[model samples]
Target chain A: MEKLLDIKNLHAKVGDKEILKGLNLSVNPGEVHVIMGPNGAGKSTLANVIFSHPEYQKTKGSIVFKGQDITNKKTNEIAKLGIFMSFQQPEEIAGISVFNFIKTAKNKLSGAPVDFFELKDEIAENMNALSMQENMQNRDLNVGFSGGEKKKNEILQMLELKPTLAILDETDSGLDVDAIKTVSNGINMFLNSDRALIIITHSTKILEKLDNYFVHVLVDGKIVHTGDKSLADEIDKHGYSTFKGK
Target chain B: MAKTQLEELNRNIYDFKNPDDYSFKAKGGLSREIVEDISRRKNEPKWMLDIRLKALETYNKLSLPTWGPDLSELNMDEISTYVQPKTEMKDKWEDVPSEIKNTFDKLGIPEAEKQYLAGVGAQYDSEVVYHSIKADLLKKGVIYTDMESAVREYPDLVREYFTKCVPLFEHKFIALHYAVWSGGSFVYVPSGVELDQPLQSYFRLNSPESGQFEHTLIIVDKGAKLHFIEGCSAPKYNKVNLHAGCVELFVKEGAYLRYSTIENWSKNMLNLNTKKAIIEKNGKVDWVSGSFGSKISMLYPMSILKGENAKTEYTGISFAGANQNLDTGFKVVHAAKNTSSVVNSRSISKNGGIATYRALVKILPEATNSKCSVSCDGLMLDSLSKSDTIPVNDVQTSDAEFSHEAKVGKISEKAIFYLMSRGLSEDDAKAMIVRGFASPVSKELPLEYAVEMNRLINLELEGAIG
Candidate 1:
């Protein structure tokens, strides 16, 4: 099977400080890849670099998505090319209702006219599965939302966008156990034989609920260890200290 | 996504101009002759002319405002204070000259009237070319007509409340307005009557290097309610144009009045408008305004709560694009116990434009137990743009409760990135954020006008990104 995303010796920096140094990873279709690292290990940097964040500079290497070189594509272009990232800290956009925001995004992604009623129904059902209030769709996007609710909102957007590759960056950090379960369930529903997910997380609790996943231990700006799901449990039991200077 | 080509402002709807064919155009300058010519041409009574002569004298004595946007470019000597269209006031839209009628037709004045308004008045240059009111409202003793007609038909009522709320001595531009003001709306709702629909007046300044001075006077009688809407626009001109219109509203005992205005003047225009309302016991007034054009603007609508339990609310927004300076805010004076006020204002500046919010809130010693809350926010689209908040809050009575909040900020890069990551282009993301920032004010407008305002914002955002 062809690789969904291939990153080779990716070296990136934000401002004057280099973050992602010589990082390589390959994600295949239908696989759940979990990246675990200590603080400053450049885990989140990898997620942002894929999107070509304006503040981050790609000093070296390349990122290929679905046989297309998107190393320097604009954020919106990358998004349209079927890449979605659930932000660690979701932005609170006032005045735009969640429903309208999702509809606009879906339309832009598909480049077609979306039926309003069908989109509304889809949002309602997804929000229901995530245990969100029925009126959440009417409220401003992420404005005044609780931490758990914001995380759920990100999941809701991921499920709605249905990208070819979805990256969840620290989405479970601030969530409670119940919220973590809901987010995991959302992830389980999103994964399919034709899709890929890269979950950059620190907790093994979420990994326990996810299946058919691999764990990669990142240290000092590089992924030094990669194994099956047992690797996540091993790292969770010990720590990133064992992977340091590897 | 429907690709929107970024270019200079798509202001063709408002920038198209007709030939300057008119029956009369007052020569550029401020003098007794021009002022008297305006009054005499309207066939006004002697008393009105005397008031005009007095106001012209006051205009000469009063100096230009020292604070706010510079007025050095506004040479009254080069501004024709009045331009009478080549037609008489017609009760029917078709009776108006084709050129002038086509202008209003292009503006959708007749269609808006047919769809929503209880009455409609169309002003071109300095004259009211068309005026009409629903027969139902006329039967209810609701007198809606142009200012000149009101001066002739209902002299007593017009004289009583003409300049009562906004006196000529209030400012230099107001004095200028009194000297040559023409073609505005006059609405008088009878006691205990409430109109379900709004009365609209659209002003179109078509002549170049001229001024538009329309006088809007509304008196909502005791226990009555009314909503008056004012719309103004002009085509682009090389020389400077002036808009110094005046609005005076009287919300009587137990009455309610809501005045809404959307002004989109040409970039070569100076908008120095004055609007005020006086609310009596148990009465209320609401001011909803949107300012999106003008080379420079200095407008601050005021409300005076004179009776117990009188209430007022002001919700306004201003957008200043390249080469525009919009100086606008709200003011309220609490004169009696239990009177209260609330203000919410927002502004956006881009491409080296400047937006300023200057406000005043005063609570007299007699105004015990009063409450006032004010919030103003400013957003700058580029670093070259500027926004400022200068507010004065004076509380004489210790029993009053007051709070004021002001915030000035630029578009958040994080927010923009978040939106762009959701599949929106940079321009689309910026435009969406701006529309969101302006949603609160737009939601306050009538539905059709809200759509129009959003379209205007989209047009303003084109070519906004460097």
Candidate 2:
């Protein structure tokens, strides 16, 4: 089968500093790929460049998703092409209710009129599954939310949007063990035969419950090693120092 | 992704102009002759004439204000203070001349009156062209009519309250307003009477290089309740125009009043309007204001709590676009024990526009245990735009509780990027953020007016995105 996303020697930079140099990755359907790297290994840059963040410049190479070259596409255009990124730090947009935000996003992606009550119920059920307060739907988006709640909100969007490829960037870094289990449960619920996910993290707490996944060791903007599941446990037992300067 | 094309929000609804036809147009200058001529045109009582003449003297004695926006561009020599339309005040809408009726028709005044208002007063230029109230309201002893008729038919009531809440000597523009004021609305809600519908007044300025100095006086008697809506707009012109209208409200003991205004003057116009209300024992006053137009605006509606346990609440917003400077806020004076006030204000500026929120809260020594809270936020769309907050808190007694919080910031790029990444166009992202910022004020307005304000915000944001 064709790859879901293919990146060839992707080189990107923000301002005058070069961040992602000579990076390459390929994601396939029904596969969970974990990219384990230390700080400054360009894990987050890889996630943002795929979404065409305005601040990041694609100096060289290309990014193709579903046979479409999205290297020069705008962020919203990329979003429309079934690509979603869960930000390491979500934005707090005051005065915009969470229900409205998700409804708008769903409409933009599907280009269909969503029934008000249907969408409201969908949001409420998702919040219940994530252990979020039902009143959160009426409050401003991510305003005054705890760190765990913010991460869970990102997961909620992933479930509602149902994109072909979803990138979770450090979603478990600041969450407690219970919140990590809830987030992991959310990810388990989103996995299906036609969907793919790229879990970018340094900790192994979120990957403990998942099965049948591939783990890649990313160091200095390059994936040095690829193995099945056990690679993640080795890194957790040890550290990224073994893979550094490779 | 391709940029989505959005149709420009039509401002032509307000930019349309009519031929400058009027029965009387005062000369472009200020003098005793012009003031006397206005009074004579209305055929006022000798006492009203004396008040106008005395106000003219006080106008000359006062100098221009030095603290706010510059007034050098304003030349009273270039402004015709009065322009009476070629029509008389008519009770029946059909009796109004076709041109004047067409103007109000375009503004949707008559339709709004039919759908939402209990009474309607439409003013064109310097005189009211049509005035009417429902028969049921009139049967309840509610007096709603033009200022000229109230001055002539109910002289004793008009004399007792006119210019009492806001003295002419308080500011230079107010003194000028008192001297040349012509067309306005007068509403007196009888004691213990409560109206389910609101009363609306629409002001349209059609003549070039002219001003509309209307006076609005409203009194809600003991245990009564009222909501008054004021709307103003004008067409654009090369020459500058001036608007210095005045409003005075009286809320009697245990009564309630809510005064809402949306001022959308042309960019070439300078709006310096004054509005004040006095709340008696156990009464409450609420002010809902939205300032969207005008080249420069310096308006600060005030509320004075005169009796124990009186309360006031103010919710206001202002949007300043290119070449516009909006200086607006609210003021409250706590004079009795246990009085309280709450103020929430928001401002948005883009493309070199300037928005300043200036406020004052004063508590007298006799007002013990009073409380006041103020919060203001400013959102600038671009780096070139500007926003400022200047708040003055004067407490004569330390026993009172007052708190003021202000925030000034540019629209966050990260927030914009985040929203866009969620599949929204950049323009939609910015507009959504702004509407969210202004929801606190919009939710307080009537549904129709809230929709209109949102459309105005969209129009202002059309060219804001590159």
Error in Å for residue B164 of model 1: 0.8
Shift in Å, residue B405, candidate 2: 1.2
- The true-versus-predicted C-alpha distance at residue A51 of model 1, in Å, is 0.8
The most accurate candidate by TM-score is 1
- What would the TM-scores of all predictions be? 0.98, 0.96
Tell me each candidate's i-RMS in Å: 1.9, 3.0
lDDT of 1: 0.92
Candidate 1: stretches off by over 4 Å: B1-10
Off by over 4 Å in 2: B1-8, B92-95
Chain B TM (all candidates): 0.98, 0.97
For model 2, residues B1-466, the per-residue Cα lDDT tens digits are: 1012123356687889999999989999999999999999899999999889889999999999989789899999999999999989998889999988888888788889889999999999999988999999999999999999999999999999999999989989999999999999999999999989999999999999999999999999999999999999999999999999999999999999999998989999999999999999999999999998899999999999999999999999999999999999999999999999999999999999999999999999999999999999999999999999999989999999999999999999999999988998898889879988998988899988887787778878887987
Candidate 1, A193-246: lDDT as tens digits: 999999999988877766669889888778899999888888878988888877
- In model 2 chain B, the worst 10-residue window by lDDT is B1-10
